[model samples]
Target: MSQLAQDRGISVDHGTAEDLPLTTNEIDLAALLGVIGYVNDLEMVFSELARVVSPDGHAIVPFCGQMVLFAELYDTAAGQEAYPDTLDWKETYPLEMAKKATWRDVEAVVSELQSVGFTEITTVKTLTQPIETAIETVESPSKGHDDGSWIVVHARRE
Candidate 1:
């Protein structure tokens, strides 16, 4: 992905969330999609985000809740029981990633962002799935984190 971006004359820096390669207040925006669960230190990552983004800059972070993992587990178990010998029964990458992830709920994420001096925090609940289905579907985004498995949080640096 970095190579593809570079080919299009877009500069990209490889760095961790806890330690960005850019100078303080160097960027106006940071988008961390599907990254919150994988990061080891939320505080450090948010601190670095606050350090790098200019005043009043925005950070967009999208993450899935722990319920998604439960849903995945249920699906896996059902698949195994239904197929028995027919199914591969091998561990998939998504399942492994979920197992290794550090799950955080919406409130915890909001608090961390606030602690790092971010303001105007807004959460939009999206990708609502009542139960895990064979066919994936997307629903319209709503205002809060009440029903969706996936949520997108937007915050502005203070």
Candidate 2:
């Protein structure tokens, strides 16, 4: 990841989310996209985000694969067996990886942001691309479907 970021000239640094290598109230904006899917300590991560970003800065941050398959998240409740409306897609990777990763939906992300004291919070425009038609609405999910497949939370540091 560092190599890729470096190649793109994005000043990427390796550090823990709980303890960021940055000063207080230093950053104007922090684009934390798709982070909670990997980290279990959501509060700590947001705390760090809040600490690093300026008072008005925001962070974009989760997941059902049907709406956003980029993360390849596997949920028992979202499986074909459970959700009959779930689309039929073959497993792309080993089941072990699925077992290890902790999957989190948008609701969880929103909860974390609220817990972190983010008041001016609003979910960004959810784009369930390729899968959801341009005319379709994500708010009202289709049959055997789930809304808020992907979420990018833009939360202002109040």
| TM-scores for every candidate against the unseen true structure | 0.81, 0.63
Model 2 ranges with Cα > 4 A deviation: 62-73, 76-97, 125-146
The candidate that achieves the highest TM-score relative to the unseen native structure: 1
Report clash pairs, candidate 1: none
- The regions of model 1 sitting more than 4 angstroms off are 68-93, 132-135
lDDT of 1: 0.77
Residue-level lDDT tens digits of model 2 in 1-158: 89998999999768877788889988877876545556778788888988998887776663333334533434443342232244343433344444445556665667777887676666543434543242243453322214445555667777
| TM-score, predicted candidate 2 vs. hidden true structure | 0.63
Point out the worst 10-residue segment of candidate 2 by lDDT: 77-86
lDDT of model 1 at position 16: 88
Model 1 CA lDDT for position 117: 98
lDDT of each: 0.77, 0.59
